[model samples]
Target: MKRIESEQNASIKQWKKLYTRKERDKLGQYIIEGPHLIEEAMNHNVQIAHLIIEESYQMPHDWEQLRLDPWVVSKKIMGILSDTEHPQGVLAICRMSSKELQVKAGGKYLLVDGVQDPGNLGTIIRTADAAGLDGIVLGEGTVDVYNSKVLRSTQGSLFHLPVVKGNLQDWIAACRQEQVPVFVSALKGAESLHDVQSSGTFALVVGNEGSGVRMEIMESADQLVYIPMFGNAESLNVAVAAGIMLYELQKNRK
Candidate 1:
């Protein structure tokens, strides 16, 4: 094991760059803090490049059996590497998966379009995982899936499922070619979500919090659906709506 006490250490500097999306994309790596996320990555077989722990933090004995060599750093250095206000004292640098996700026949997926909020995107991902969806395709204008806040919000579900970036138009086309129904959520001129029978195989498209799905994309959907609002409030949050829709679609699936 190596020890890093200085904040100016070269490795520390490089890992700190992971806080930015550009650096994560350029290096094809991202950082996940907290022991739960790290353990989740290990459990899911996500490639972990490095394990970092603050010198004062006590690691569980089981972690010692892992193949990874831990690097002990001072709390000060960990603070620089941590994204959270309260540092968990543990973090891992992980390599991005290289596997390409294809939209296959009879598979379920969530097509996210222009969702700018990190928390919402993360929740959507976690919900999709719980719903037993095959994968998530992030459409253009969506926030970077590797964003720290987004990663934290996923609570390690990011490691449980495949999340890839792609063009919604092409994905929609591919789903249709495979005979998978494409359902886009919309505020107007749409079928109530309750009325549509769950096909067990589908691609549900959700969109920006403010504007909702793009008009052109909505027009391209095999069906447009909306949740019936019984409350006095205007509408559901994107993530909440997605959870409701995904569960509805998945409950009847074999």
Candidate 2:
């Protein structure tokens, strides 16, 4: 195995570019860390560019026989490339192609509005997968779906569904075209989520943790609903609210 000991190694430099959104966009490649995400990508049959591993990290049984690991890297170099606290010891740079995210809600769709927390976004992606969402749309100002922390949070589940990035107005209009009810989570004039029955084909618009959905988007929603807050605490995390909404939506789906 070719070892990359020098920090200035060309491949190392290329992988470092994964940290930047610009570079990731330019290359159409994003970095994925840990065994879980790698396995997830594989299970999803997404194209794999390079599989990098440290000498100490054992390659998975499936990976060992594959054409992966074009090169071996050092712990230090792997550390430099990884973004996690406890690095997965293995990493892969994957090429992502558009999954053709559809706004027409056939089953369920999650529309995120400027959610910045990586963990929150990741959890939401995982939740969406569990809920059997048809797709997810990231409105402008929303966190990058490929962000490292968000990627880690998803634990490879992001591969399960179609995720698209665009403005809310345009996508919501498309949903309306498909006759899907739009449900917006709002703090005011919002009906109790339990009181309102979820439609089979529906879209859930989740706002930012601090600021709710943009006024324009909220105004366009067919119905605005709120999760009943029994406790005295303030609103729930954007992701938590998303999970609840998905739970209810999925419960009604089946």
Candidate 3:
């Protein structure tokens, strides 16, 4: 195991760059903080580029059994590497999956359109995973899935399935070509959510927090569906609405 005490250390400097999306994309790597996320990544067979631990942390015996060789850093340096208020004393640098998933016919999919809030995007991704969807396609303007808050909100579900950054319009075209009905969430000129029947395979398109799905994307959707609002609430949170729709579509499969 190596020890890195100085914040000026070259390795430390490179690790810190992972905090930015641009750097993460350029390097094709991201940091997963804490034990649970690390474990989830391990279970998913994610490649660990490197492991960083607080110098004072007593390395867990079970962790030692793994193939990882950790680099110990001072707590002060850990704070610099961590985005969280409280550093968990453990973080892993992991390579992003190089494999891009092609949208397949007869598979369930969630298409995220322009959802800017990290928490909402994370929850939606997690919900999609829970619903047994094949994968999620993140369209233009969606929050960066690798952002710390978004990653935390996902609770490691991102590693469980194929989550691809993509163009929604192109995906819509692909879905149409594959005969995978694409449903968009819209208020006006949309069918009631309860009324649409799913063929056990389709793509659901959800959009921005305030504006909802873009008009161009909506026009391309095989259909537009809306959740009925009963109370004085203006509308459901995008995450909540996504959860409702995802499961409802799953039920249609049954």
Candidate 4:
């Protein structure tokens, strides 16, 4: 019911800061666009700092009865909030969930190494959720999971899983401490995916788009494995490769 028409409104200025990762870190919040992502955040009980809607657009029927009233903004202001070519006219400011990753005995985990593509990272997260993995550890060079493109590509799966950032070496050591075998996906001097059997409790490391896993991490892995490529194509997209490896690792467990 509250309307903000001025582009220079103090609240609007503060909201714009969310567009950058630094500001998001400083403010402890990020923006999620469209109805689906908003619904996902709401369902997860993530703290909704603000529910912002374009002034010309009517609030969704389901949202009107919510305990929080939507803050209406001018269409010009909505344009500033939107990152996409076609604005969804609805967006939310959501607090980041506290990091929930801890290596446990007999747990299945995915370790990502410097995966820079937002879409690929998002797909990998969705795949991990579908595979029912315990959690995902994102190494230093990985893209921010909160990146807008990555968020959109996740299709709400990110909210369904526990994802946390960590140092790859520390994570590897923790897994080893728990007796979980760590397997690195590599292109050379590695066993085939078919030849590598999961130990039930294991950690799978997927790497960068072009460079693959870092040499140091690969060397530290309990074993290195590669997907068999019989077709003309040289390699698989990092995301596709991840999906295959994760599913195969769990295939015989049941």
What's the residue-level lDDT of 86 in candidate 4? Answer: 91
Clashing pairs in 2: none
Between candidates 2 and 4, which one is better according to lDDT? Answer: 4
**Candidate 2 lDDT:** 0.86
Q: In model 2, how large is the Cα lDDT of residue 43? A: 85
Residue range 184-216, candidate 3, lDDT tens digits? 999999988888888888899999999999999
For candidate 4, write residues 1-254 as lDDT tens digits: 78887888998889888888898889889989999999988888788999999987777777777777889987889998898999999989989989588899999999999999999999999999998989999998999998889999999888988999989999999999999999999999999888777778889999999999999999999999899988899999999999999988777353
User: Candidate 1: lDDT of 110?
Assistant: 95
lDDT of each: 0.91, 0.86, 0.90, 0.91
Model 4 lDDT-worst window of ten: 245-254
lDDT of 2 by residue, 1-254 (tens): 67787999888988898888899889999999888888889989889988888888877777777657556777888888888677778888899756887655475788999998889999999998888889899998988888888888998888989888988898889889988889999989989888777667889999887898999999999999989989997799888899998788656653
What TM-scores do the predictions have? Answer: 0.96, 0.95, 0.96, 0.95
Ranking by lDDT: 1, 4, 3, 2
lDDT score of residue 219 within candidate 1: 87
Candidate 4 residue spans exceeding 4 A from truth = 252-254
